[model samples]
Target: MDTQKIPSPTLTLPKSLTGIQGLDEITGGGIPKGRPTLVCGSAGCGKTLFAMEFLVHGAMLYDEPGVFFAFEETEKDLAINVVSLGYDLDKLVAEKKIVLDHIHIERKEIEETGEYDLEGLFIRLNYAIDSIGAKRVVLDTIETLFSGLPNPLILRSELRRLFRWLKEKGVTAIVTGERGEGTLTRQGLEEYVSDCVIVLDHRVTEQSSTRRLRIVKYRGSTHGTNEYPFIIEENGFSVLPITSIGLDHTVLSERISSGIPRLDTMLDNKGYYRGSIVLVSGTAGVGKSSLAACFSDAACARGEQVLYFALEESPQQIMRNMRSIGIDLDQWEKRGLLMFHAKRPTFYGLESYLTAMHKAVNDFKPRVVVIDPLSSFIIGTNQFEAKSMIMRMVDFLKINPITVFMTHLTTGVNDFTGIDISSLIDTWLLLRDIEIGGERNRGMYILKSRGMAHSNQIREFRLTEHGVELLDVYVGPEGVLTGSSRITKEAQEKAGQLLRSQEIENKQLALERKRKAINAQIDFLKAEFDAEEVETLNDIELNKLRENLLLQDRIDMARNRKGDIITNKNSINKARGNIAKS
Candidate 1:
């Protein structure tokens, strides 16, 4: 009869501003409620963006008003900077959902007194918050205070006071600071804002710039410690948190055709999986774009919207080229099933491109996306950054369950130059121009198709007025043809052999039909001769009849035998040739 005492349960928490996509899972809902978060970073590390996004999202998504105080940029510049990200700061200000206050603290414009404190900042922030009833506050680049006030001791004390004041105000705040060499910030602000610390980094690896965000420490809460990759897109920043989802898990059982029946056959009796990433890698002038367009046209024909991002070629150029290949992309575009985004890889930073891509995905909500020649993006970035960008892109695509087609340019027949993106793809199709004998020919082969059995043989491909046609599998002494030389020789041999066989078969079938008709005429002549009156036949008539019947029988038998022999010989030769080649 002893009763056990029940322990009190921990209180469940509310949602917080994750500052990233898919980051709330790691933080158990968000940062602690109503406390300041410190975001410290070097130049161009996106600390300002992180803090701005938090406030913007809070105002827009959670129905909480926010206040943004900038010490460096003017309110106009901040509004313009976030405009591309789909944040209408002007409208938000009008609606009283958010307030932006820019404090111009120019050292040359004003002289600081000895008893100067952040009283003005406190007053401005207090007025903005009370005016808008803001639940979130952000001070972008609070380090600008140091630029105006040269004394570090006073700045540190002021920072501590600012944190305490923000807590007293009970508004969750983000204070951004510049990173120092050894310390977190040049003014040691990290010590003052000890509740939460986040570090943003922008580094160049292998000539590519990558942005990463890390949680240095979160007081009274658990947070992810690893540096998560993030991209600044039109809709704001998208942080990529690497989860442990297994790659081998079964995808959707549905299949989609590659637009070419022959190519589909090469894949399998079925086709590519619904949500698979297809990589088409080959040398220059190998028609990767045409292949991608063909696939796109097929999808469009099936009523699926496609988003095609051409990094190297303009949309008009792609449309003209595809038209030359007999693919009418213009019609699809007019029908609103195909959208093209053509831009230079170096037009903006990698994060900007990522952001643009993100915006396109959200706006279009396409079923399939194609990025022509992913290698072009590798020019400004190092190998590691390129790899990371590609990985994040793939992960984002996977989450959306959208089919992606990427093309890469290789250097040689078997040599992959620059960054190798094959590892991130689910299916790899290698197209090459093989040289055989004295002519050049095109060949295509599927190097690998994960989770499916595909043809291992290299098949010849040809571009015609109708479209791309896949020729028979290349069977030669040097195995399959690869370059232009090999392809030419294989094509010539195959064409000759096919023509010769068809000629012989045609001759045999024609002879067989002629022989059967002759046999019928001979039988009829014999019957007439046998049925004629036996007593009164003239010698010339009988002799003529017998001679005609004999001639017809002889012709029929010889022709039929010739047809059979020719047919058998052709079949045997073809079998022997195949065996010999094998």
Candidate 2:
């Protein structure tokens, strides 16, 4: 049978790269080229910052000079504001790569008239664009430009003309606006006249704030519609588009160590597959962090970079604690192979956390990532939201093919992560406290490991001064034993075996003595028989001598012993016959 493969569409619309992290990917390349894109949001929602970044990126990175026509802030104020975000607008202007123009409209000096038009503003913008040969333009807060005009008909006409003039100038532009109550923009016309519309949102839930971005409309292009989380920091605007990731990331057959050799033995004797998501879950104080540290130490020893996110403990605290278990994380930190980012879960919202992590991972470019006690993310959010955030993180890390070792704190003996992210996990290890004989001991078991033959037996987990150790738990008729119970059971079996051996030795010794006594009795009987045979032979000899002497005397008396000797046999027979007849 022949297989058929469908080819993907090759046609795509012309777009100018935004140069902002993760934003271009969501927009399917970027905003429409040689056209205006409307970015609207409420106060302090990073609308102006987004526009400034677009212009600055075009000037500095893409070699496309830009013009910033600001109506809200002056040129000096714009330069000062963006300087903190690492954008040297003054330098770009000095280099003739950017032109900043401040257009101030005094509403008190304006009167509504039919002769009103944006022709004057266009001439000034046209001069600025031509002076620098700019390919990008940013009109921050376009509402102020027409705020003086109270006539709605003229405002709409001027908005369309302004967008059309930007396209005619062949420049990609961003128009910032204040979010309206019922519409996307305050004037409710910018969204319709622009080629693409992006909405920025700043939301606060439970006293925690997060910034999100959404592409409301993209004309003549395909774009991501999901509400993506974004963050503004010293480095600039970063958006984490969760929907931009897919399950098509490649899987690796290569395996990496879990840091604990015995634990690796339980995991098909090779360890976790590289790029796989490994979840280590246990109740409180079950060495979850310790296990994570071991993995970090092992990765750093192999000269691979590791990013550790500690939500509960501080970096110093984690390092000090790990030192108690013979895992020196400080050494790896000094070697620059390990980094610890410690923060509280409440320090940021779920989306903010995801965005920050996304940025850190991208910047560090580490091969291994460790998130200690992932359950802390569940403290302020629901299970669904937490799982969603974690799923996005997992997808992002997998795309980088980084080995992930995440620790989770469970409330009970069960391995449920509370976020229900087991399906996304490639390997799940459960650590539990086994209580027997009035003592508690740690036990580890591989709950599930996809695509590997893992051991199902529970191993007694020990945290020695050296490292983590996994020993075989005693499984017998009495039940699974561990700790002192296992040792005691082993001692009992040894004693029983020794007793059986001693019994066999004693029986063999008694049988040997009994055989020796029987031999001694047979020797005594043979000696007695020998003495009796000697005496019987002596008596027969003496009787023979007496008979011979008596015959000699009879021969001397009778005329010669020779005649008696010749006839001795016949005479003896005749005498015996005569005696019988008498």
Candidate 3:
């Protein structure tokens, strides 16, 4: 029976994470799995490091063993060089997590002959992958084979076949190449590994060096179209993600104290919103640093971890200065609630600064982070670039509920803040130096606060031993009260109030005395009138009794007379009647 012709099954494209966060971000997920990606760059662009990190990350982060075929550097040389990055190649090799093969091909030893294929190279790679069960492979700078072999026609044909075979083997691979004149790789190696391509670039402008990584082409994958900066630090590599924008970060409605109770009140809020960015801006010696210290002290008092980034002053110097203001940051440091990271801005590039900051924050894991005077962060960078860096940093920190305070030193009279990151800030506190009577006074007020009520009136603030004291807005004839004028005016007003109070008391005393005298006079007049009334009444009663006696005596006399007359008449009549009776 004839063998049935078998058709191959359809293959789905798989993605393998390179374990580099920024790289993974740029590539969307990672390089296409079981396929080769071309990485081309000129000298010292970290082309080799990129490939090595891919393998190392695969082994460490993904638990996927990798095979590295280095065409330029020997295994011993590679192991020694990567030691600084904290990658131990020897250990990984011993653990059977990786296999390192350094293939040396010299033009002097090889003579190009006819009908030759790269089957030997394929055999070596197959055996290594099978032995270690590597799911990832890196043929570093495979374009070097062009220099070793003279026949271009045969070399090109074999190179195409090699990429195909690697893809067929079902292992993710990184093939590094040197940059060419117009094409991607020096040997025009972009044709074979056309699925995904990355270009590394190193350039110096204005005496500052920056390394940028860009994805030239990702055939079937959506990726970030911007160039991202990467740095190699002590711990490992880090990518300053240029794409930190979105609502993807976690938001919080909760608030935290500004470390200054009065300042918190001025925020017109519960406090600064958790995971919000705060900017304190002022001229020189306007208590910007003092305010930052207060905030740090406040956070420490709450038993919250704080990361203090002192870009200008030494840690001890800052501690000593804050101590004078009654803010004991050293105590917090001792208690392990506060950590101080001090460095000079002039000694490092922007990338290095961000890398250091990122590492410090990750390691420390503080709820509050302070960059004392972010003005120095723009020392060597332009305003736009510095603000961009700050924006990215803010996005990074705001993902958690970590509050950030960055102080900016104002320059001119017009510029309230030296930089214009106000648009990105959640709460902006502006400090002004008011010149009066040949003295500089610090006035503070809130310029803006998102999602909260804030006081607009400027307040005269003083830095005392107890920290920042935001005094009441003294509204006087000239304006708000401040300094000696406020004190003098208050004293004068108090004196006037005392004088008015004394005058009122004297008038009340005089009125009370006059009232008492009048009352005494009224009592005497009433007694005099009562005596007169009693005397008049007695006289009238006596007159009435006398009249009654006289009238009764007269009446008795008249009755007696009348009775005598009647008797006389009766006697005469009686005589006449006696004669008639007889």
Candidate 4:
């Protein structure tokens, strides 16, 4: 079989970067280049701002001149609105890099009786494009242009023509539209554009509003289909793509201190892995925030930047409170090594908070971030949302390789689940109150720490004037002891030990006395034996003298008898023998 080897079309599509943080990443490098993209949303959903940002980003960042045809606002209104974002529109205008045209349509003047043609509109748009040699265009809205014309057939035709003309003009464009009932746009502009369609939504749940963006459709391109949370502030628009960050982030082996040396000792003699998520969870007044402050202090002391997001307390209040623990957070703040963003959790939605954190991190480029009491995010929502937000947050920070130290205040004294985000944490430090001897004491232990051998012993720590001092909890026959009980037990043991030492000393002295008495008895026995030996020698000498005297007397008697018996020697010997025989 003969197979024809046909060349495959380029898998990648030409794209224009939006220059908006996280927006370009989700849209796969912005919307399709040189094509019309529809941005539709309800009122106050930032549809117009989205489109304007596209144009402004195009002009300023890409060096591509742009034309913005506004149907709702004038040039002055648009410029004033965007000026807060630090965009000098008038300067761009004077430079002939941008062209702003406002199309005014009074609905009261037109009737629904005739065909609507956009030839005149086309001429003005073409002139604007030609004037600036624009490569990007933004139509503030599609509804305003067709508001006077009620015929759907004519609206569809003109919408298609508008999109076609923009495509032929070879300028990447964004057309803003009001959301319709169950439709993406009021006039079904998504059908005409066909290239790209983005939907912005401002939804309020539980009295909290969050602005979100989702790519509805993109022809011939893959994009992030999930709804991405976005924010608009003085700095400008930002989109937070949750799934855009994956688990492929680079990991680090470096470790940073938690500021408490004992706590670090509990964690494998190292504090925490760099670019890892650490969660400190505890009950109320269990010193969760204090531990977080210690981490921040340690990081700042190391000359690393820390972004502390305080949800409950103000920066001044936190600094003041931390001062009692001998931690001067204000010094780090003044030195510009630490930055605090204190805001109430209810001030905005979770997504807004996420976006704010994202912006703060991006702007500050912090090496470490501290979110004290992450449980506060669950004020109005459930744990699911908070966990999702935290997951996204962890993913973002992990990718940046920033070490995150978070504090979570548990609801119950024994409850360890703080928004149920334990699985996302790499190191979890659990603190609780240990009640003993009618007194409560603080104890901390590592619940889990990945990639290291951590201590399982619960260390009772006190928040004294010198900071967190971890104490050794006594474990004995009375179970674990802390507070006064531990102190009392230690004192009793010390007294017993002292008494035992005294008793041992007395026994050693008694043994020494016995040893000395035995030595004296041995000395006395040796002296008695020496005296008996001298007496025995004297008795033997006396017996020898007596025997010698008796022998002399017998010799003298024998000599007298022998003198009468014999005269010659031979005869005396013979006579002595005969007398002996007789």
Alpha-carbon local distance difference test for all models:
0.80, 0.86, 0.82, 0.85
User: Model 2, which residues run further than 4 Å from truth?
Assistant: 1-11, 109-114, 150-152, 245-256, 272-277, 297-308, 314-341, 348-369, 382-403, 423-426, 435-439, 448-453, 476-480, 484-582
Clashes of each: 19, 0, 1, 0
CA RMSD of each candidate after superposition: 19.9, 10.8, 11.8, 9.7
Q: Name the best candidate (by TM-score).
A: 3
lDDT of 1 by residue, 461-556 (tens): 877767788877556676765445555776788899999999999999999999999999999998887867553466656776676566556546
Candidate 4, residues 1-582, lDDT tens digits: the string is 546765344547889998877888997788899999888999999987888887888888899999999998999999999988889889999999899988887777866656557788899999999988999999988678666556767767877888898999899999899999989877777778888889999987777777788998999888988887777865688787755556788889998888999888988998899999998888889998899889999999999999999999999999999999999999999999999999877786777687788889999999999998788888665566677678888988999999999988887776567566777889998898889879999888889999999999989979988898899999899898998999999999999999999999999999999999999999999999999999999998787667655655555666877764344556546544644543
lDDT of 2 by residue, 1-582 (tens): 435654344546678999987899999888888988999999999999999999999999999999999988999999999988888888999999999999888888876655666788889999999999999999988788656667767767877888888888899999988998888877885645558999999987667676789999998887899888777865788786755566789999998999999888888999999999999999988888889999999999999999999988999999999999999999999988999878776787776687678778988999999999799898555565677678878988998899899999998997778888888899999999999999899998999999999999999999989988899999989998999999999899899999999999999999999999999999999999999999999998787666666655665655453565565767655544644543
How many Å off is the CA of 487 in candidate 3?
4.3
Where model 4 places Cα greater than 4 Å from the true spot, the runs are 1-9, 107-116, 130-133, 149-152, 245-256, 273-277, 296-309, 314-342, 348-369, 382-385, 388-404, 413-415, 423-426, 449-453, 476-479, 488-582
Model 3, position 234, has a per-residue lDDT of 60
Best-to-worst order by lDDT is 2, 4, 3, 1
* Cα TM-score per model: 0.67, 0.74, 0.76, 0.74
List the lowest-lDDT window of 10 residues for candidate 3.
5-14
lDDT of 3 by residue, 165-214 (tens): 89899999999999878877888888888999989888875566677788
In model 4, pairs of residues that clash are: none
TM-score attained by model 4: 0.74
Cα miss at 578, model 4 (Å)?
47
